[model samples]
Target: MDYTIEIATTDFITTESAVKGGADRIELCSAISEGGLTPSMGHIRKCREMFDLPIFPIIRPRSGDFLYTDEEFDLMMSDVKLCKELGCNGVVIGFLLNDGMIDKVRIETVVRAAYPMEVTFHRAFDRCKDPFIALEELIEAGCQRILTSGQQIKATDGLDLIKQLIEAAGDRIIIMPGSGLNPANIKYVAEATGAREFHGALRSSAESKMEFMLPSFAAIGDYINPAIKENDVREFKKALML
Candidate 1:
């Protein structure tokens, strides 16, 4: 395929919906509000049964940052083993130093643990104090692909850096664009970065059963401007067609 549409989804329902709406791959996981975390074995199994597309689980142990402790690294290793056993197509992970650099040691440990399956470095690369330095480390660490927003608040905002990264990658690694990708600009982002892959979450919050219980609902970025908009999967696909 010339274009790959990657949709980040938490539950099986979301995964199924994405595939039906034309997503090519699914980054299977849960607790997306906290970024993402490893999906349960049951969730992975359900997704594997439900869709033919590749499912890559997010192996992040916590949400606040990309920095991980020794305990967290061990947890990630264990998580990768379980993900492989459950037949996940790949695993997405990243680890960083306190000063915002790739933790090559931890990444190596994970790559070793996830043997035979593909590995993707997640947005943690965006947090790296230095993208160029981190990209080299990831290449050395043997990560096959990286999902980044060009280290900007939005992918569009970082178009220039993304272009440079794409040129620098030069087929040695995949530079998947994610974060702030929407139908309105996906085509533009792809053209600018020369990336074949795209990643985003297509979601809509209907009235939650417990809306009035205490909290109404959680929005991905702006809580105060909580306006419900259905996930824009089809729009993205349509843009890709043009």
Candidate 2:
């Protein structure tokens, strides 16, 4: 069976690492620790120019909740437009109503705005009121894929639902499992869920190289840098083949 690996890259450096590590696609973002946000134009432009891989920049405007105010939604629209203009392969997005239902009307509008670029409704699907209902709605909205953890914290823990979702999705859309997945368990997820694509940060961290540091700066939590390791990314792909 063929498998595709998507690496969530937080910046140009991590993006490079993912590519070198053989990522089949890139989910470009900023502030991945906050569960990903829209990356800057510079990051988008440079990656589009340099990489031969598909780059889908996440179109999220903030950290918490899939529900957004009108102003925030506008920002997301602008970001989506910018990604297309910069030649990104696609955009990742999600929106939810207060009751945890997908905001289908708004999502459809965003899909229209995205035009030729494909859209993958992000994990906000997991936060929705119903998985099966949202799955059909996303398909109707023209999303090419849905990145989900099957409404659980980790895709592994949600294998039963993930498998069921795969069965339910059929050929209507691609269901990619993500969150807390790594090289070690990717094969298991693939076999269990019968999914062809997978997503992960696959990150490793290193302390700052700076020799001089302010002692008080430690309070802000900036000492370590997290990034997708090339070997780790390679291992994820390798595991799928094995």
List where candidate 1 sits over 4 angstroms from the true fold: 208-231
Each candidate: what lDDT?
Answer: 0.82, 0.92
Query: Candidate 1 at 22: error in angstroms?
Result: 1.2
Against the true structure, candidate 2 reaches a TM-score of 0.96
Report the C-alpha lDDT of model 2 over 1-242, residue by residue, as the tens digit.
88888999998989999999899999999999899999889989999999999999999988999989999999889998998898888999999999999999999999999989999999999999999999999999999999999999999999999999899999999999999998789999999989999999987776788887787885575777776679999888999888
* Tens-digit lDDT string for candidate 1 (38-150): 88888988888778889899998778887777787778888899988988889999888898878998888778778778899998998888898888888888888999988
> Candidate 2: minimum summed lDDT over ten consecutive residues — where?
218-227
Predicted structure 2: lDDT: 0.92
Best candidate according to lDDT:
2
Predict model 1's lDDT versus the native.
0.82
After superposition, the stretches of candidate 2 with alpha carbons farther than 4 Å from their true spots are: 218-221
Find the candidate with the highest TM-score and give its number: 2
